[model samples]
Target: MKRKLIAMLMAGVTAVTLTACGGSGETSTEGSAANAEGDKNYKIAVLMSHQTNAFTTAVSSGAKDKGTELGVTVDILDGKQDPNTQASQIETCIAQGYDAVLVEPISADAIVPAVKAANEAEMPVMTIVQQMKNQEDMAVSYCGGDESKAGKMQMEKAMEAIGGKGNIVVLYGPMGSDAQLSRKAGYDEVLKNYPDVKIAFEDTANWTTEEALSKMETWIQTGTQIDAVVAQNDSMALGALKACEDAGKDIPCFGLDAVDDALAAIKAGRLAGTVSQDAYGQGAIGVENMVKYLNGEEIEPFNYTECIWIDQSNVDEYIDK
Candidate 1:
């Protein structure tokens, strides 16, 4: 065990040294910032894609709680679901000499340059919930759900509920975002098996309830039969559900991120079901991994939490967690 730990520490040191040597001659103090302050006193910056809904907020809450428990300072910066905002924030974290950074990216491709800059500065940037482009080269590690798997599970369940044959309206997240792309990939994979199920209408809601409501209202006006609503996230799911209810159109809705509201809706028999990805757990674990990396300890390149299916039959088992 001691030898293995030593090997891990040596590998980390070598990587940092090489990266730091290749950087512009200006000295970067981030490497020693945590050590100088002593263990458990390091500062970490958590860059969230956005806090527009409960899921992102829950992730930040968990990170903050873990930071407190670990006796480290954790600051969360909102990106407002804008790649530019996230990139700007990453620059600020680098300038502020933070010990580490955790990012929930707004766009996988758009966030690459910022991540590359962090890498050039020899600042460890870990991704949570969403991935940046070339994740293996850009970020130190990733901690989140398997978006494709989650999408697959969500679509499969929705198909099962609808008997695999119906017209469904798909509400998407921000296009080009990691979750949006990967989850949709999962959706498409399942869709290949259900030839009778057609996508009646689809559009991007940008992961907001209001946006989803507006989109659904517009789609409803088209007068096309929508049997089930499959949303990438719960906020959009609830919004789509609301539009159907207001229009007196009964439709079964499925969503990911089994948030509190979604869970309540399931128990109330308003929602069909949702896939539960532990947003809070993802945040907490990301912070934990950051600490390990900072301390020259071994950390997994990919840390994924389990995604569970929740409906009235199993909603009780997941209500509190």
Candidate 2:
């Protein structure tokens, strides 16, 4: 009987050992699944001011395509040209625990705090197109066309087209944007080289066709003989064209941002020329940089792409039919 009891006890011990081993195997499988989920999934957020324009749209498209290539899921949020909305979007990104954020701030100053918060969260933030005011303190990198250079180049081309002497009108964009400031600086620098070219009047168009048209109409009412109009962007250029037509003025107009409409205007001989920043290139590069950062690689603080001059001479190659 004792021998029988000893055998039963041995069997019980064997059963307990088998149970423990099975439990350990199940735990290992669960742990592996959790790890796999973490590796396969990553989230990135892109905050844009407005997608209505070609420039910002190109930026968004580039980010989307690049994010996909790197196996990251991207979320694009539009601020609708509202600074408050943009700030809220950044906060939302942080609350949702996004792995990284890419922002194109609408207002340079308003977005500073939100960007700081993102930085505080240890989230890598990238700015494109428009930069924040305190950029050095907040963003990891900036990727976009050099706006000041764009402005300077546009002015130089305008002066060249007009034989280096003209009474020019300046149509500026949003009042407090870094792009506008840089572009204006460029304009000022280029104008220094051509003393004969005088700025007759400067007006703010706010980067809209209607606003520019209204502003130009007011200038026309003053009876200023505008030899050429320099708009900060293509939309404003189109507006200037309308105003010129309304006032019966046949003057050469220049614009930056080679949008489809701008290219069309150039073909129609309504606009003298424009500078193309290759928004697609900006988007592609921003994405490339973001991916590198994600993979623990160092990135440049500023990446400036080359700009192209688009005029009737070479508009066919750039403009879409």
Candidate 3:
């Protein structure tokens, strides 16, 4: 039912409230593509990696809000986590003569040619969330969190929770994704300083709760002594937490992407902690920067928002603002 609702929202058939904006109660939907004046100054395309997840949905909302604020037309497109689909969308954007584009890349390598195509067409492209390979040479501006820093902070918090020594089961995102690789690098960097900390099991769950739950259940059945679970995203973290609860195990689980559920879990002492990337701000700022670029104003090459660690002690700061 939730997925059906999301699909409807994505299709611009209905409106939905966005999360990750605290409790300001601002509403946004995919249908709001025009400015308040009803005459758009520029037509921009906001291509998302996927619209199914809370993070990406909030991003889409942010882009829409910014577009409305700036009196421009912003069309939201879902990539469905496929590079080919995103490439095709870019081609469509080019053929339609979009004034600018904001891309949330799914694969760093696969997105290069598509971005290059946009460049050849003389269209401005800004990347949000995960960056593509050779980012400087491709996207004109970037607005998102530092994946490496987020991973480092998440691991450090988990390590601190587990007393710096334990067997951790790491839940990964898509195997070769930019977030997966860079976050793993950060985790490895942190593990280097703590020799007692070992990775007992690690695999990609594709950033989904169901897959993470299934994998964790199998790990439990195998009798692996998992001291903690570190998930790449909040959805997987919640799944891992559920699996542990079902198995009657008390495990400290950590995650990135401090979504609302994760924050509530932290408040209720179910989740250990998560890293905040300001998903909404990333989308809004990407559009804002793209507008600046289009208006012949100088903008920063890389615009990264703050990535902070959220735990029980500070979860209230992020919940229901």
Candidate 4:
């Protein structure tokens, strides 16, 4: 009887051991399959500053199109020009386990910590338009139009229209933005070549048409002889046009970003020209580069798209009427 009881105990132990081992093996196999499924599904997140602007809208559209083409599940988050919000969105993307992050930073410095966090989490971060101060280490790729070159080209067209000498009013955008700073640097460089061209009044319009209109109106009230207006963007240029019309001043105007309104203004001869920086291309390239990096391909640190000066002489050809 004692031997039979011992035999029964041994059998029970063997059955339990076998059951546990089989269950463990099944779990391990399922886990491997789950990991494989996760690998096959790519997730990408794109964070942009604002969508109200035409340029940003085009960029968003381009990113969506490219992401769809590449079979990526893209999550687009709009910061609405709020830097802190943008940073938070990046962190959320990281927490959500995105494969890659493509950002058009509202401010370079504000987004660094979030980008760093993503990097630490092993997520590839790509910057568009604006670059971080320590860009070499922070971003996998920096892709966009060269703001400085665009600004310089626009200024050159303005100078050409004004015979290289005039009293110029500069309508700038937000103070610390990379685009604004680079564009200003280019404007300054071009202005240096024309000593006779005096800056009548230079002020920030905050990249808004309303603000630009108010600022230009104030400048006009001050009795400044503004022969030409160099608006950092077409929206502000349109605002300046309103002010100029109100004041009965027919001074030539120049703007960046060949927006539809700007193109129309150019055709109407109200504005001289603008530099066409393809925002759509910027967005498309950002996603494309992220995809390439994921596929173990190297990407350029700096991807600069060319700019074209759009003026009355050639506006019709480029404008989609």
Write the residue-wise lDDT of candidate 4 on 1-321 in tens digits.
001122321222111111111012210001111111235436677787776677777676666655555555556677778888788877777776778888887886787888889989999998887677678898998898898998888888788878888788998877777888889989988999999999989888877889989988999899877778999998898899899999998878888888788888888888878888777777767877887788887889999977888887888876774
Candidate 4 lowest-lDDT run of ten: 26-35
- Score every model by TM-score: 0.87, 0.84, 0.88, 0.85
Off-target runs (Cα >4 Å) in candidate 3 are 1-40
lDDT of 1: 0.82
- Give the candidate order by descending TM-score: 3, 1, 4, 2
Ranked by lDDT, top first = 1, 3, 2, 4
- For candidate 1, write residues 1-321 as lDDT tens digits: 001122222223211111111123211112322332265577688888877788898887667666655556677777877789789888987887878899999988989898888889989999999988899877889999999999999999999989999899999999999999999999999999999999999999988999999999999999998899999999999999999999999899998998899999998999999987788888878987898898888888999988888899988877754
- Considering every candidate listed, which one attains the maximal TM-score? 3
Q: RMSD of model 4, in Å?
A: 17.3
Q: How does model 2 fare in lDDT?
A: 0.76
Clashing pairs in 1: none
Model 4 regions lying over 4 Å from their true place: 1-39
For residue 31, model 3's alpha carbon misses the true position, in angstroms, by 11
> Which of candidates 1 and 3 reaches a greater lDDT?
1
TM-score of candidate 3 against the unseen true structure: 0.88
Better of 1 and 2 by lDDT: 1
Per residue, candidate 3 scores C-alpha lDDT tens digits across 49-75 of: 777678888777777767666666677
Model 4's alpha-carbon lDDT is 0.75
Candidate 2 or 1, higher TM-score: 1
Q: Name the top lDDT candidate.
A: 1
